[model samples]
Target: MKSNNTLTFSRRNFIRTSALASGGMLIGFNFFTACKDKVAPPVDISQLNFNNFNAFIKIADNGIVTIFSPNPEIGQGVKTSMPMIIAEELDVAWKDVHVAQGILDTKNYQRQVAGGSQSIRFGWDALRQTGATAKQMLVNAAAAKWGVDASSCSASEGVITNANGDKLGYGDVVKEAAAMEVPENVKLKDPKDYKIIGQDIRNVDIDKIITGKPLFGLDYTAEGMQYASVLRPPAFGQKLVDFDDTAAKAVTGVSEVVRFGDKIAVIASNTWAAMKGKKALKVNWQVDSKLENTADHDKILMDLLDGNSFDTRREDGNVKKAFAEADQVIERTYESPFLPHNCMEPMNFYADVTADKVHLVGPIQTPAGTARRVAEMLERNVDDIHLEMTRMGGGFGRRLYGDFVMEAAEVSNLIKKPVKVVFSREDDMAAGIYRPAIKYRIKASIKDGKVTGYHLKEAAINSNMYGLIPNFFPAGAIANYKVDTANYNSNITTGAWRAPYTNFLAFAEQSFFDELAEALEMDPVQLRLDLLQNVKGTTDERIQYSGERMENTIKLAAKKANWGKKQDGVYQGFSAYYSHNTHVAEVAEVVIKDGFPVVKKVVVAVDCGIVVNPLGAKNQIEGGVIDGIGHAMYSDFGFNEGAPEHTNFNSYQLIRMNQTPIVETYFVENELSPTGLGEPALPPAGGAVANAIKAATGQRLYKQPFIKYIGMEEQELIG
Candidate 1:
C-alpha cells in the first residue's frame, strides 16, 4: 500500500553508511550524520518527488538538503521550529532547503518521541554535530579542488569561501564532498559566532499552514486507502464480547466490518461512511460491573491521599516540631483532576501493511517508538517498519503515546490494505490517556513574621515526569532540605503529559508560599526575593532549577506586573516555578465577574536559554499559560462507573479567545542552551490564577477544577 508517488532516494544509500532512519510520511530534507568528514549527499530540490515521497530526505548531484522528522506536529509549530535546528548549522539558506517526514527508519534517528518540551533540547547536540560535520566536509572538498589549505577555506551562507574570496556553493562541491570521509571532530559554532541560531526567525511552515495544504494525518490518502473507525472498550479493561456486523455492512459505502478480540473496526470508503457504519453497528457490550473504575477510581485516589502513602518532595527543618512551636501553622490540602488533551484536530493515523513491509503515517509524536512497536507486532525487522508524522492541531502531550500508531498498524495488518484510523472528538476524549489526578498536603511553620520550615507532602503515580532534560537545571541553590515520593498503582494507566509531576508540584508549592506570605503580612514578591537572593548562577545537577534564573524571572515578572502597586478594584496574585529546563514566573490579575473571578491580565518572565524564535516561543508560553488556567479552574477529571466523566467540549471546559487575557513576556539576556517551553508555563498559571481567586474572593482553593470545589458544582454527583 506504499504510495506509488513516493520518491526513491537511492542516492542517499549510495553515500552515508552511518545513517539511522525513522518513520516519516511526507515533507522535509534529509539530514545525515556529518562529522568532520563528508555526509552522503547534498539536497537537490529539482530531484524532489513531491507527490509520493519517502519520509527521510534524499539529495543528489546538487547542494539541496532534505529533512524528515518523525514526530507529529499538533499546533506547537514543530514543523518549523524543529527543522530550524538542522537548517541553522547546516549552513543552508532557508530558500534552498526542503523538509519531509522520514520513511520510518530507526537506526539513525532514535528517540523519535516528542514530549517534555524536548525537541530542541534533544536536537541541540545531535543535529548540530551532524550539520557541522557536513559543513566541514564541504569546505574540505572545496579546499582540495583549489589546492589550498583546508583552514584557508571557510563555509558561510551555503557557500565555501577561500582566503582569496573565491567561492563554491555547497551544491557545487557536494559530489566530491560526499566521497570524503566523515570528520572525527567537527567544530561547533560558538554562540557568539552563530549565524542562524539565537536569532528571531519566522515559523517556516506558516505559509503552508495558512494556505491549507493537507498537512496532517487526516489529509493523508492513498489511491486505494480506506477509512476505519474503532469501537473501543466501553470502559477500561472491558473486552469485546459480541457484535452484529450485518447492519454495518448495509451502511452506504461500507465495505467491511470486522471484530478482533475486544475491539471492533468499521472499514469504509470514506470518513462519513465509516462513522455511519459505526453508529448502525449493534453489539452486546459485555459491560463488566465488577471493578468499575469510573465509580471507585476517584474515591480510591482520595483514600490514598488520606492515608499514609506520603512521599516528601521538599522538606526543610522538622515540619512537625516546627508546627508545634509555631505561633501560626497553616495547613491545606490541594487536589487536581484528570483532564484530556482535547487537541483540536483529534488523533488519527494511516497505515498499509503486507508480509513484506508495513508503512504507517499520521499525526504522531513518537514515530520512532511506534516503529519499534510495529516491528515487534509484525515480527518484522525494526528497520523495515516505516513511519510518517503529520503536523498536529494541538498537542498538549496527547500525541506522546504510540498507542494510536500501534492501533493503526494492527488494523492495517488485519485488513491487508492501507487504512486511516480516525478518532472522533468523543473517541479522542474517551480513549485518551489523561493527566493524573494528584493531591498535595503542604505544611508550613512561621513565627514572629519570619519563615522557619516548609514541607510539601505530595501523593501521585510519580512515574509521569522525567527524562526531558538535555542536562538538569541546577536548583540546589534554593533552600530546600528534602524531596521524596510515595507511589500507588491503579487500574487506569498514566504517562507523561507536558511537565508531568512539575505541574502538580508547582501549583501546590507556589500557592502554599502565597498563603504564608499573607500570614506574615509580607509581599509575596519580597518573600520570594529574600529566599532566592541567597542563590545565583545555575545550581549543579543535584537540583532542577537555575536559582539565578528563578530570581531573575521573579524579579522581571514582578517589576513588569507591578506586584505591590494596588489597583482600586482589582486583585492580583503571583506564582513562580522552574521546570522543563525553563524558569517561568507569572502574575495573574483578576476581578469577580457576577459570581466568578475572571482573569483580566497576566504577565510572565521566561528564561528558556536563548529564544530561537521570539514570536514562536512567546506563543508557546501564552498557550501554556491558558492551558494551565483551564486545568486549575475548570478542567475536571471525574469518573462515573469507572469511566471518564466528561466526553466532549460541552461537559468539559476550555478557555477560548474571549477568556484569554493580555499576556506579556520577557526573556533573559544571556545565551544559555534552549530548554522546554510547552509545559513549564502551565503549572504556574493554575497557581497564579488560584492565588488571584483567593484575593478576589477571600477564599483559598484547596482543590483543582477550582470552580467545582469552590462552592461551584452541584453536590449531587460530587459525593
Candidate 2:
C-alpha cells in the first residue's frame, strides 16, 4: 500500500543519480545558433564525451563557465536562481558565469518542470552537489599537478590555489579534471560561505532583453518556418463536423488547410495571412448538447454542494456534534468564476517533425513532460524527440499543460514541414482550459471567542484534478474539522492556475474567519494566532504545515502592517496561508474610491526559509499579490452555450497599473532549507482584499471579481 505522504519521483533525483553515475561531474554544454553572421557547423552531440555534463555545466578553454538551468524559465527567475545554487557551491563569480536554457531530457535532467514552484525546493541539494562535485574535481586536478594533497588546495573564484600561492584557473585544469574520476562524496560549502546564493544578482538575460535580442518564442525562426493559425471549436465539448478549405486556400500566401480532431489549421507564409486564411475557412461545429451556459454550471455546483454524498477528503473529531453544541455558528458561501491565464506571450510553439525525429522549440513550462506526451502522441521514441525551452512571458500555471505544444507537432506532421503554431489573442482567450470555477461553503462554530468546529465543502467542475490537497489550512488546527468535496462533470478543460485551489480557497476560508472573529468578539489577527497556538504541540504527524512557521509569518505581517492602528481613509485586513511549502501572511489596506475598491498598500511577510535571491523573491511576492488582487477584483470568465463569453481584454478585465498598490515585502531570516516563493504569496491576497473591502464598505463580498457587487452593474452568467 502506498502512503499518503510518500515522496514521488522528482527531477532532482534524476539529475543527481545521473551525475553520480558519471562520477558526479557533468560534461558538455549545448549551444544553439548564437551568432547571426556565421551558422555554427552541426556536430554529433552524442559522440562528444562532454555530453555527460550536458544538462548542468560546461567550462570552456577561455575560463567562461556555462550552467544549464534544467527547469523552464516561465518568468519566475528559475533560470537565474537555480544556477546560483550550483555556482555558490562552486565558489564561482556570477559575472563570469553564462546561463543557458536546458533541453527536455528526462534521462539527463529528470523532472524539468516549472509549475507548483518546486524547482528550487527540489533542485536545491542536487544542484549544490553538482557544483561541489565539479569544484572538487578541479581542486584534485590542481593538487595532482602540484604534487600536493588535494586537501591542501582551496578553490575560489573559479580557480584553485595552493599554499605556495600558485593558482590554476578552472579552464587550465578542466581537461585534467575531466580525466579524473568524480568523487562520490564531495562536501558542499556551508551557507555562510556562499557568495552568490543569497545575493540579489541581476538577471543574466536582462542585457540581451533590453538590447532587443530575439529570445522569445515568437521571435524565433527556422530556415523554412511557416506560420500556421488554427480555428478551434467554438465551444467546449464541440467537435469539428465539417469544413470547406477552398476559400482559405484562395487567400494570398495561404499554403494549405489541414484538419485535426478538434480544430482546422491554415498554414501560410506569414502570420497575418495564416490568421486571415483561418478566418476565411468555412467550418461547422456539432455540440453534444445545448451549450451548457455559466448559469447551468453554477447551478450544478450548488446542487453538488447541497447533496449529501461527498468524497470525504479529511475528517477529525465529530464536526456535526461540535457544531450542534456550539454557542454560535457563522457560515458563508463563496463562489469564484473561471479565470484565463492570459500569458503575455500568448500560446505559440514551433515544431519540425520528420520520419526519423522531431524538434520542438517554444515557451512551455513542462518541457520533459511535453516531450514525452508528444512522443507518445506521435508514436515515436522519446529519444527521437527534442524539446527546447524559451523564456516565457508568464506561466501562471497555464503553460504546464502542453496541449498547444501537441497541436504544433500535429500541424507540423500534417504539413510535412517546419511550422509554427500561433494562437491569436482571441483564439487563446476563447480556447478552453481555464482555472476551474468553484464554490466553497465554509462554516465555523465559535464558542467563548474560540473556534470550536469548522467545515468546508468545495464544489468544483472536476475537482482536485491538479492535486489540490483539500486539507490545506486550518485542518489540523481545529479540533472538530472536516473537508468534503463534490465534482461536477463538464466538457470545458480545467487545469492548474497559480496556487491552484489555495488561490480561491484562501479567500473563502480567511474571509469567513474574519466573520468568525466578529461573531466571537475578537480581533481577526488574534483569532488566527490563537488557532495557531492551539495546534503548536499536537502529535498529529499528518499535519503538513508547521504551527511555529505559520505563527512567525503571521506575527511578522501583522507587525509590519501595524495590525490594529487606525489610519485616515484606510481600513486594514489580515490573512495568512501556506502553500507550495511556503508560508505567507499578507495585510491589505484599502479605501473605496468612486465606489470601487482601491488598494492603497499591501504588507507581505514570507517564510520560504533561506531566500536564494531576496530581490527576486520579493518581486515574486509582489507579482503574486497584484495578480491575486486583479483576479479577485476584475477577472471572471462566463460561458454562453459552452463558449467563453469574453473574447479578449476588452471584455475580460485585468488589473491596470493605476489600480496597483504599494507592496512591501519581508522574509523571515533562518538557516533552514529554502522552499518555493512563486505561488505562496498569491493565495491570501483575495482574502485580505475582500476582508478590507468589508471594513471599508460594511458589505461582505461573497462572490469573486468583487467589482460585480460594487457600484458596477452586475453581469449574469446566463445568456
Candidate 3:
C-alpha cells in the first residue's frame, strides 16, 4: 500500500542563481511562492566561496554535492531524510552527497524550529524544488555545450547524457550552468522514479556519532569559556532571598560566583569544579506561592472537571438530549501523572555575550526564537547575534523552551565572557519542564446498541488541550458530540512533552472506546470501522483526520497482529488515533507472567504519507512505542510540597532492556505529503497497552503507571 503518484511543480516564481567563486553552480529558489521578498545570499557567501544556493545546496568542482539541513535534529532523523528529498530531485548519488547542518539564517529558512515534527512536511516542496532546479540548470548547461535543446538531455546519478549517449558529469557543466538563467517550472521526479528518497540511507552523522565526534550540545566548547552551574530555588513556588558564596569561592578551581534574579551561578574552569562550588554555596529561599503537591493537583484537576466553568471547545447535535433519550450510558475517567523528558544528555548551552555582538551555540529546538529573545534581553540587534545549532541527545519537547539557553546567555552577559551552562541529571529532572498531569472524563450514550452521543471533559495543570484537538478523531464519527476543558494554573512548570495533550488523551479516549465496544457486544475493530464509516466522505472542515486514512491504518495494524484471533496464552488489544496530521493504529499482544501482564509484542501501522527513509521512519515508530509503553507502565513523576519526588534514574523508573517488547512497524504508503511520524506513533501506544492489560488480567486500569494498580512493588517491576 504505497503511493505511486508523481509530483508536479506548478508555480515557480522565485528562481535565482549566483556563480560560485570556484567555478561551480549555485541555485537558489524559494518553495513558498507567498514570500515575495528576493532571496538573500548567505552572509559568508564570499568567505565560503559559495553563494545562497537556496542556502540548502552546494556543488563543488570535484563532483561532491553538499545539502544543508535547516531544522534542529532531535533524533527524529530529519537531518537525514530532509537531504534525501533534495538529493532525490537533484538526481545525485547519495554517496557523493554530503549533508551539513545549516546555521540559523532566518532570511533563507522558515519554520526552522523542530518541535512539531513538521520539518519534512513543510520543507518537502522547497527542498525538492531546490534540487530539481539545480539539476535543470545543469542539464541546460550541458545541452548548450552540445548545441542541442535541453529536452534532448537527461540527468541521472549526477551525470547528464544526451540522446546520442554522450555524457558529462554535473561538475563538468557546473561552471557553464553558473552563468545560465535560472529555470522556472522544473519538473520534479515521480514517486515511482525515486531512488535515494525511499532507500535505506543511514544517518549522515552515524559515522561521526559512533566515533565519538563532538556533534551534541554537551560536547560544544569555546576558547577561554568558563563552565557554570546554577542553583535556584529547591522547589516550585519558592524564591531566592539571599545566598552566601564565601564557601563556594573557597572551593578548588572555583573562579567566581554571580547572582542573577533568584539564582546563583558558580563559575569555574570545569563542570565538576562549578558543580562542587555550587553545592558549597549557602542559599536561603522563601515560599512565594502555594507549595503544591501531587495530591493537591489531583483534587484541583478533578474539581475543575466537576465545576461548571469551562471553555467549550466543540459541540454538536444536542448532547444533553441524546444522553437523556439514550437507552444506556457508559462513562469512564482516566488519570495520568506528570512525567519528565529525561533526555540522555542533560540540558546544556554555550553563549558568549559582548557589548557589540552575541554568540550563542547549543542544541536548541527553537533557535531563531531563542536568539531573538537573547537579543531583546541584551538590547542588541538580532543581526548582531550569531547562533549555531548542535545535535541534541534528545528533546522530547523539553528543548523547545529556551530557559536553559537564556541562562547561558544571561550568565555570559553578566560576566562579559563566554560561558557554558551545564545542568546535572538531578537539575534536569527536578527543574525541567514536565508533561502536565491530566484527567479525562469520557461519556457515551448508546441507543439501539449504537453510539449516539459523546461528551468529553478535560482537566489539566497550567493549560488545556489545543483548540483543534477537540475536532480530531471521534468528533465527526459520533453524531452528538461535545468537548469542554478547564485548567488549574500551578507554579510548577508544565508544557509539551512529546505528543503534548494527545499523548495521554488518546489513551483515555481509545480505552473508553474499547469499553464502549464491550457494552455494545461488538468487536473493538468493528466498532472503530463503523464509526469511521460515519465520517467517510465527510466535508466538515473542522474534522482534522481523514476517515479513509485512519481506516487503512487500523486495518493494516489489525491484520498484521492477527486481531481477534484467540491464542492459548496471548491477549490482544487495538487502539487508533490521529494527531499531528498523521493517522496511526497499534495492536498490543500481552501475556501474563507471575500474575503480571507483560507486553510481548506491539504491531504498529502508520499513515504518515510516503516515508522519506524507511529505516529512519521505522526507528521513530519503535522509539515512540517504547517510550509510550515505558511511561504508561513504569515511569511516574510526582510533586511533593512543590518538589519533584524523583530526581534521577535511581528513583525515577523507566522500562528497562528486558521489559521492552518487540515492535513491528508498517506504513500505509501513499503519495500524500508526509505528515508527522515522531509523536503520532506515541499517542496510541499507551491506549493499546492499557487495553491489552485489561484483556490479559480482566482488570480495568484507570490510571497511568499500571504497576501501581497491580499488586507489584516498584522494586519487583524494576527487576
lDDT of 3 by residue, 1-719 (tens): 54323344532344566567666655555533323233344333562332223454778877798776767899999889988988999899998898888777443445578887777778777777778888889999999999999998999999999999999999898888877877656787888899988888899899999999899998988899999999978899999999889999999988999999988999999999999999999888999999999999988988887789888999999999999999999877788899999999899999999877788889989987888888888888877888889999999999989999899999999998899999999999988899999888889999999999999998888874332278998999999999998888888888889998798999999999999999999999999999999999998999989999999999999999999887999999899999888999999999999878999999999999888999999999999999999999998999989999999999889999999999999998788888888898899998999899889987777788888876544344321
Range of the 10 consecutive residues with the lowest summed lDDT in candidate 2: 32-41
Candidate 3 regions off by >4 Å? 1-13, 31-44, 47-54, 106-110, 464-468, 711-719
Off by over 4 Å in 2: 1-54, 106-109, 464-468, 711-719
Reference-based lDDT, residue 575, model 1: 92
* lDDT, candidate 2, 583-635, per-residue tens: 89999999878766689999999999888988788889999999999999999
Ranking by TM-score: 3, 2, 1
- Top candidate (TM-score): 3
For lDDT, candidate 1 versus 2, the one ahead is: 2
Per-model TM values vs. the true structure:
0.85, 0.91, 0.96
Give the top-scoring candidate (lDDT).
Answer: 3
For candidate 1, write residues 84-182 as lDDT tens digits.
Answer: 666676677766677665434554455555677876775555555556666777788899999999998887778889999999987677667756765
Q: Relative to the unseen true structure, what is the C-alpha lDDT of residue 347 in candidate 2, on a scale of 0 to 100?
A: 92
Q: Between candidates 1 and 2, which one is better according to TM-score?
A: 2
Clashes of each: 61, 3, 0
